[model samples]
Structures are given as C-alpha cells and as structure tokens.
Target: MLPFPSSSSSVMASSYPTRFCFNRECPDFNRHECYRPGWRLRNGDFADLCSRCASAYEQGKFCDIFHQRASGWRCCESCGKRIHCGCIVSASAFMLLDAGGIECLTCARKKVSVGPNFRPPPSFLYQSPIAEKFNDMSLDWSSSARSYRPPNLSGPSILQYNLHNRGDGYEFNQPTSRDKATAYSTEKQRGMNDLMGKLMSVNSNNHSSSILYNQKPGPNCKVPTCPNVNAYQPLISLKEGPLGTQRAFPVTTPIETNGHLGLDERYLWHKANSSPLSHLHNDLNSVAPLESKNLNFGIHLDTPGKYQVVPRYCPKVPYKNQVLQNLSNESVSVVTPLFEKILSVSDAGRVGRMVLPKKCAEAFLPQISQTDGVPLTVHDSTGKEWTFQFRFWFNNNSRMYFLEGVTPCIQSMQLQAGDTVIFSRVDPEKKLIMGFRKASVAQSSDQETGLNNNRESSTNGDAEPIDKHPPTEKKKSSMTTTRSKRQKVEKGDLSELKLTWEEAQGFILPPPNLTPSITTIEGIEFEEYEDAPVIGKPNTGLGSTYSANGRLSAEQDDEEAKDEAEGLLTSPKSTSKHPRHRNGCTCIVCIQSPSGASPKHGRRCSCTVCDTVRRRRETLLLRKKKQQIEIENKARKELESPNSDEELRQSANNSGTTSKNHEQRHAPPSKAQIDLNFQPERDEESLSPSNTTTKDKSPHHDETSCKPPSSSSVHSRHHHHKLHVDFADS
Candidate 1:
C-alpha cells in the first residue's frame, strides 16, 4: 500500500468491491486479482497493474512488449534502431541532436566524449556505483522530459522524476521539466497541507507522528523541496515493508526537515513574494563548471526570497584584483607614460610600420645592437597581446627604429593621422601598455604647442628631466596654459600690424579697360592682359575681414575685392553689340555713354577714353599689318626660288588668300572706316600725309585695280587701308 492514498483511489475503494489491472489489453484486466503499482500518473498516484506488466516495467522493457505498434516510433540517427518516443517509459533512452533527429544513448555516448567541463544530468546524481561508468557522457534530461507525453491522455503532460537507490537511501531526481509551472500552485498547496499535518502530529506525539508520516508520505515531496535533504539524513528508509513495499519517513527531527525543506515561516514569506527559479533560469547557460579552481560561490540560501537551491555550477564570484583590472582596462587608464608620438600619414597608412623616436626608443626600449631587432610582445589598452618586429634602419649615419606589423592594431582602433599614441608601463609586472588619444577639434591648437615644447626640450637636453609622475589632469592643464600663451602672442602681433593705402593697393588692382586677349597654352586658354595694371584700393571690407591668421585673411580679402572690381567693369550691357560698331562695344564706349547711346565719336575726338580706345585699335591693326607683311615676304621668297615648282606658286597664292581672310576675320574697324559709312568721299583719303595722291597705291593695289575689280575685291582696297590705319593706331 502507498503512503498517501489519492482522492480517486479513496473514491474507488469505497465504490468498487474489487480492482482490475490498469492495462486495458491485459488478460486479467477486469478480474478480481492481486495487482502491483506500475507507472506514476498525473494525479500523483501509481497505476495498478498485474504482476506480468509490473515485471516488464521494472526491467525497462514494458514499452517494447505493450506499445510496439504505437504511433510515435523513431529510428536512431546513428544505429538505425527504432525507439518508442510516444511514451514516458523510454524517455531517457534517446537524446535529441542539435541538427535534428534522435540518437540512442549508446551512439550519443560515442559521439560526445566527456571533458573536464562536462556535467552529468540530475538523473545520474543518485545512481548507484554501477552507473558511474556513464558519467563521461552528458545527457539532455530536460529535453527528454519536454518531449514525452502519455499516449491518448488529454490532461497535462506527465513529468518523469525518477528515484534511484544509492545503497544507503533512495534519492529523488532533480525536476528538469520546466512544465512544472502548470502544477506549481496545486503542488505548493498540497505540500503545505501535508507539512502542516505532519508538524501538528509531531507536536502532539513524536513516535505516533513518525508512524503516521511514514504511513502517509506526501505526494508533493518533489526534488525541489529540500535540495540538501540527503546531506542531513536520509528521508526514506531502505528497509522494505510487508510485500516488499518501500516506506519513506523523516529519520531526523521533523522540525529540522522544515528548515531544510524551506517550509517554515520564512519559506512561506519567500513563496508569496518571489520565485526561486526566476534568476536561475536566466543565467543557466552562463553558469560555470563546479570543478573550476577559480570558481567561488558567495550566494547564501538563507536570505529572504532566496529559498531556491543554488547549484554547485553557479556563476563564479570575481576576485577584487581581477574586477579592478577589468575596470581600468575598459577605461584605458595609463599608469605611467614612457613616451608618446603623433601618428603621421605614413605611420597610419597601409605600409604597416611605425617610426619610433630615437631618444625615447634608446632610453625606454631594449637595447638592440643588431639592425634586425627582436620580436617584442606588446599589450594594448584592452590587454590583448600583439607581436611586432622591433627593427632599426640606418639613415644619415644614424639608426631609426621602427615597429613593423602595426597595421592590424591601428585599424582595430580605427586610428588615423594626427592621433596620439602613448607608450606606458604598468608597475609590478612592468609590462608595456599602449594607449591612444583620438584627435579632436580642441586638440589641434594643443598639438602645435606640444610639438614646439617637445622641440625646445629636446634641444636643451631636458626632455628626460620633465616630471613623469604628475596626474593626467595636471598634464592637461599645463598643455592648456601653453596653448593660451601662444594664442595671445599671435593676437598681439596682429593687433599691432598696419598697412598704408599704397601698401594695400599693391595687393590688388582695378580691372583694365583693354579686353584681355585669349592665348592657348597646353590646351588651356589664359586671359593675357597687355595694358599696364591699374593700382587701386578694393571695395571689400578689409578691416573687418582680418582674422587671427592675418596674412591668409588679407590674401582672401584681396581675391574677393578683385572679383568685385572685375564684375563692375564687365557688365552684360557693355559686352553686347551696339548698332554703330561692327564688333561688340568697348569698355571706353560704355564708360563714355553709360546709357545705350548710339552717336559715333569723331576721329578728332581726343577725350582720355577716346584716346585710349584709338590707341588700342591702332595697336591691333599694326600687329595685323606686320603679320601681312611677313606672309607677303614668305610668298615672294617661295615664288622667286629657282627650284620653285607649279605647286609652290599655287601654295603661295593659297597662303596669300588665307592671310587676307584671317585679317578680315580679326581686324577691328578704324575711325575712318566707321566715318566712311556716313561720308563716302573719305574712301579716297590717303594713308600718308606726305603723298597727296587719291590713294596709297601699292604694287598689289595696282594689280588688283587693273583686273576690273572682281566682286570679292570690290572692297579689298578699302578693307586693306582700314586695317593699316587700325594697326598703326593700335
């Protein structure tokens, strides 16, 4: 007979006169015969079965004999042997694989070789000495508990919590199933009632209470009740009752059990307030192995709201030194500064080499007599170790040290040029630690001041004498003071500097009246200014535009002023063509008549603007005449040559025609040419006042006139005379 008679069992005993085998397929299922307890049920009572079925269950072959044709049969991934998965009896026979599919215990043990970190499941904790051989294999008992479900049952899934005899006493397995959440409330209530009844009976009479407790052991006395229950005294006796039935009783004082089981006033308080497994479940995977030498457990189960059993494999308590070291490393705090250097473009580039200062390397680093220095181990701020080739090269009869293979470290920190890296040494170990400071906007001014100070100290042979023990804050303040002094000196120099009007005028010039000629040099057209540059003050506000860098600010102001002056001179209206002139109006024409006036200026008009325009036109025409004279000379030379062929005469004629066309395209009209349109009698005017002839008749002109004036030459004489006057004036 069981210790605790469930409600259903009591009702059945009262209603039915006889009992039958629990298995429907048994031959004696409905017969009034002796039966034995088989598997545990959801109601926390054992199923009564005949001797035959009970014998098979004890031998772990009940599923093979009775449930052979059940639906949930699966083949082992390794052995190809079928295992019944639909029932709870064979739950521990297989293990689930991470890749999907199941592996039998034999195959699983062969694959997952146990290591020092492997932990046996809770089921193996209470197994006998014979089961110790299997300790090398770890099983996922929780997965098996989750996968098992009673066949054809609509109630909640059955949780398998096995009990194994360890020679001295029977020990309950740890409840690995997380599904206990569904029955926790009911289980807790039932456990409390049983505990109260036991306590009341024990208070009444100790010997009688022990007997009643042994006769009616609690069904809710699961593994989670008292984790260390076996440590104090065995809760169940190995001695058998009548018909070889096992009886469980509190071998020690029941009061001690209440304390260990956490069912006293404190336990009730914790139960109502907090859950024991809340934090444990979250940190389950992070728990370290109990065999670790560095592992420490600081948790105390006696604390309020901490009734949960802390496993041996809980998270380790970190040491004080380790915690402090971790914090310092994360913050990148340097203990002692050996030397520091700002990374140049080459050092930060993919070249993967860092140049070290000669003085600092000789003073702090190991003495390397050889050019190919030793491989040095360096630790970064994060305590990550790196190997760098510390070599030296000869330069200008001196040795220059370099650290090769620093590209990985530099890239890991995302450092670039202008960033400062500090070489530091920590005490005790005297290990070299490398730290870095990223370049920021505020550091730009400080960098220049620091460089100047370093140079001065190096020259005075006092670089090694500076205080090395000052805190970082003191060093920062000193750097700031130096920067401020440098800035003040620069400001004082700018405030005292002044420039006169003439001195300032030398920096900029007014736009000239003559249009710049375009000249192509190397496929780029440059505006060639031929006239004398006009010196004048710019309209830009130079006084307000002055900055800390006075020279650069002044240059910027000069450029701005030149652009504004040029914009005022080259107005769109001035560049546009006027009805009077053949080409676009000149700057002088626009200046004399700001409005769109069209009355032509006479050749005798001698205003300064008119004179400048006339001289410019004459210069252009003279250049054209010179070019024509050169081309005629070349043609004459070619035609007079003794070896001249017919092709040479034709080429001379072609060259003459081309020169005439080019002159017509580029030559500007003269005052006389403009006047001839209004007064036709002026066409016969002579170019030279010495000859009072109707025209300055050249040999070419005479030849052209005798030809009866072809349509193309009708205005050739007038055009040539016009070009000559324009060229001379220019």
Candidate 2:
C-alpha cells in the first residue's frame, strides 16, 4: 500500500507525496494539511492514513491534542456530547479539553481553579451502586499502583483494579520485573481481549458503553464520591468527592451519567459491534455529577486534558447596551477628577484582573474591582513576598477595574481579622496569582465587590494586567459611588441587570434590538371626596415618595438589600384565598402600565405574552419575505419566455440542440403549424409595444439587445402588488 516504503525509500522520499483521508476521525488527517489539497498526493495505494499522519510519522512528531503524553489520554471526557446542539441542528464545536483535563476556574471564586499545576489533586463523593462496587475493590491511595503511572489495563478485574487504582495516581498491583516480562505480552493480549469483552458487555446492564473503555477497575470509580467512604477520612472523602479531589478519578471506568443509555437500536442496518466515536473500542461514558449541571456538562471545549471541566456558558450581563450612565468628563478639579464609573461587580462575583509584583506576566484573576491604578503590594499566607503582584481577569472590557474577592483565592489560602494580605506564587502558565486573604476588624467600606461568584468571561485567554489599587488610602465610597455625590444616576444602573441567553435554553434568540417588551400596567386612579377630613394619612409610602417615572432612586434600591433584610419592612400579609395585592395588580410597582414589562426596569414577570407576540411577528415577516421573492422571480421568468420573433428563434434553436432523439421520436411540427401556433405575432401591430414600434418595423427584433431598466415601475408595481400582502393580520 505504501509502495512497500522501506526505510531507505522513506528516507529518499523524505518529502513523501501526501495523501488525504476523507474520514474526520482518521488519526492521519491534520487540520492544517486538509486546508491545502494540491500538495496532497493521490497515489491509490500511497498510504492508508491521511497525509497529515503520514507527514507526522515521516517527521516523527504528533498532535498534542491526541497523542498520549506524561499526563494521560487526550480523548474527550464528554464523549457522549457528540450529540448535536439541538435535536434538529448540529454545532460547530466539539467537547474538547485543555492539557490538564478537568482543569477549570471555579465559577464561584475567580482564584479557585482545578487542573494539573493549577489546583491540587481533586476529590470525590460516592453514591449507592457505585459504592457497592467500590466496597468490593481495594481502597488504598498510598500504594505504587496509584503513586506511579499504570500499565495497560486489559481484563475486567485487571481493568477494574487499574481504574480504581489509577485515575488519581492510585497504583495497581504489578507483578515483579521477571514475572512481568514473562507474562506481559500474554497478559497484555489477554487484557486487550478483556477490554473488548467488557466493552461488548456494556449497555447489557445499566452501565453505559462509553465508560467501558481501555478501563482500569472498580465500579466505585464511576461515582465522584462514595457514600460508603467516611467523610472525615483524609485519604478518601466521601461527601466532597467532586472533581477537585482524587475521588473524581474513575476507579473502574468513565461513566456516562447524563442519561444516554449506550444503545443504538434506532437503525436496522447498524451493526451490534459498531461504536459511534471510532472503530478502536474505548468507552467514553459520562462521569458528570448527578446534582450539578456543570460538573460533567458535555460542552466540547478544546482544552488540553482528557478530563477538561466544562467552562460555564451562562448568559452574559447585557454589556453591549450597558452604558456608563453616571460619569462624563466634565470640568472638575484634579483632587478626584470625577472617577468615571467604569464597571462594578455588584455582588459576590469577581472581575478578573492582573497585578505584577515583579516581571509582568498575564495573571488570570477573578473577583475583579476598580481599585486605584497603582501596583498592589501583596504578601503570601506563607509570609513569603510583599506587595503581591497579582493577576485579575477582565472581560478585556474597560480600563476601569472592580474586584470583590468574596471567597479566598486558594484552598490553602485562608484569612483572619488583623492578618495582612500577601502574595505567594504567580502562575503565568495558568494565568493565576496565589495569595492570602486577610480579614478586616474595622468596618471597611461597607460595600464589597461580590467575589463569591467566580465566573470566567474572557474569550481568549490573552491575560491582562489589573490597574493597581492603592490599598492604604481607601476611598469612602469606592465600592458603590464616591460617597459625596447624591446627585443621582441612571435608573438602569441601580439594579443588577442580568441578560438571558436563549441559545443555552434551546430557544431561537432575537437580534440585538431585542429589549424587554413594553407592557401596560393599569394604575388605580382615585377620586378625592369634597367632605373628607383634612387629616393627612401616614404618607402610605406611595404618591409623595415616587419619582416622576414612579421608580425609586438607586439609594432607595440599595437600602432595600440592607434595610428590608433587617426586618425594617415586613412583607405585606395576604388576606384572601387567592390573596389579592392591595393595589389589585400583582406586580410590585403599582403605577407601572400592565402592558410594558418590568424586567427592563428591574422586576420579574409572571407572563409570557411578549415572547409569544415576538415569535409570531418574526414568523409572519419571514414568511412574507419568502413569498414576495418567489413572486418577483416568477414574473421575471414569465417576462423572458419567447415573447417575440427573435426570442422564438432562440427558443427553437435551444430546443433543437437539447434533444435530437426526442425530435425524431415525436415528429417535429410542420412549418405551417408552427407558423400558425405563433401567428399572434403575424400582425405587426400586436408583435410590438407602442414604445418599441419603431424598432420592430425592420423585423430585426432591434429592441431585444437593450438591457431592461430596473425602473420597470409600472410592471414592478403590478408584480409587487400581485406578489406581496399589503398588511399583517393582527
């Protein structure tokens, strides 16, 4: 097949002509080489694999994404995620992982990320059936089977032992060197057979086929943490057995817990032995957590490892429309040039930013904030370094910075009141800064950037430096506003506005123009009585308190989180069975018109009216446009079909050349008959329009050559009217 390419021949044909493989899964096909086909050789028997693989072999190199390395297999952990985006459509992306599989920044804490070299070994929690299987297997973590890399896992017991033994460095029992040499091949071949047998046996039970891989061992490996394992045990934690711990390693096999029962009974022609991913039999069963959606989500991101944690793809804050409403560069003194309201993380979420203690490198920080643009001095919990040059992640968003480190940065990172914040190691490779969080005894600015939510919003991991904050001179209103300005701000900025992504929810989304639709909320208008007592009622917290737009100021809203939380404002008690709100409207803002939505103004809804209306209008318009185009095209075709003598000649010529055999089978019409059929043009007057009469006089069809004007308005108008509907039905 390779021209029997000997080492000499291969050396001679060093630039061996390349060949392409059509199969996407072929190890030989390189994404780069596929884009270039001319250099691709097409020797029918040149090579079995694609040119890329051949080239790689010829050059002695391999793709980092697929080749086995010191770390582990690079195959997808979310193998079952090969499922298309929706039932009807496929997505452009596949579930890919980074180099250190299962490495992901914690969405709740910017500083806490999991991956090799980034976070420490992960843990797991065990549940029922998995625990039962685990109970049958050995549970040692300090042995060589775990501490060192394992050999091939061939048979069921061997594979189970390997799986339970290896996912997190748990070693399996290996034979002595002489014994290994004597039995390695036979045992390995036997193991390979066992691998095949186990793979085949999958789906025969509740276990899925993807998890039945070149597996190691023990059913407990599938469960993140086993309930049977004691929680306080330092060696194996049963409760917190998340991917962050060693328990996440599949002791037995990778389990597909996302509910795709590894069976393909849909097709009559599909073979019993066929697999969806590849002919090479390895199970990629779901190992996602049963409770958390993200723990084992099937988003195919191209990270480096076999166990890449799915990055959370939540709806973004509506940043495109998010205007910095409060600040404009007006004439102000230099004391504090009206610090522009760049961006703020209102609650426990962190903004990613970077700080340099020494040489500059990108740091992936979360819990961002708009600190003073000064290099921050940091000291590590180890009391190692001072003025911590930390990195924070930003949306690459704006120059203004804000950070709210709600949770500490590291598992080893802890804080206590009166302790000093410090910097430790700066992981440039992972774009992270490690340090200690110190607590405050005195009330620092009461407002804090909520750093509890550690979300990663940066698209490309091109790290950024955080404009340093001067920690010593703390501004009174740095968290929210410059405590001085009571001048008010835009109403929209008052509340934490969230955007919804219809794509994630499997709903077709509207364009950027989409905003919360207007809903009219009917306000109760009251008539004042003439003989009423002049005693003013206790303000009722309504008419006198409302702004012109009937919306509260940002200050009032801020008070709601603090004041109402303190039981200062008790929730109104409901009296009726169907509990009517005092204002008759079920909404919080009584003055709002029922038709306009309160969501755009910070209120939740109990209706789906707007979405339905929008979908209907969109569908109607799309249908209308499609119909209009079809009609116009049809009219143009009609206008060109052999309408004149020359057109007739051209048509006849084309028809003649089209099929000589058909002309002979069905005898051609007689000259007289054809002449009569088109005799309507015989009358010179009828053959030409009034405007073309002069050109038609010579019978040369002189008007035929001129281009038709786009301004055929009369005809266009007639065509348009005939094609399009004038109005939409309500």
What does each candidate score in C-alpha RMSD?
35.2, 31.3
lDDT of 1 at 95: 47
Judged by TM-score, which candidate is best?
A: 1
Compose the digit string of candidate 1's lDDT tens values, residues 495-544.
21112323433322212223445433333333333211211112221211
Tens-digit lDDT track of model 2 for 1-730: 1011111122222332332232223443423233212111111112223455444433323222222221221222333211111100000011112211221112211222211112111111111111122222223322322221111111111212223323321121222222212313223324433433343343333222222221221122232322211110001001111112111111122222221111111100111222111111121121211111121121111111112111110101111011112247421110000001212112111223322211011111111122332233322324333332222343354223322232333212422211222211111111112222222211121111112122122232321111112111233222322211111111111111111212111111111121222222222111111111111011211111100001111223333323222211111221111111122322222223332223442123333433323333344355346544654554456577635655443333322222332222112222221211011121223212232212121111112211110111000011111111001110
| Candidate 2 displacement at residue 380 in angstroms | 13
In candidate 2 the C-alpha lDDT for residue 420 amounts to 23
The whole-model C-alpha lDDT of candidate 2 against the native structure comes to: 0.20
How many steric clashes between backbone atoms does each model show?
Answer: 7, 117
TM-score of each: 0.22, 0.18
Leading candidate by lDDT: 1
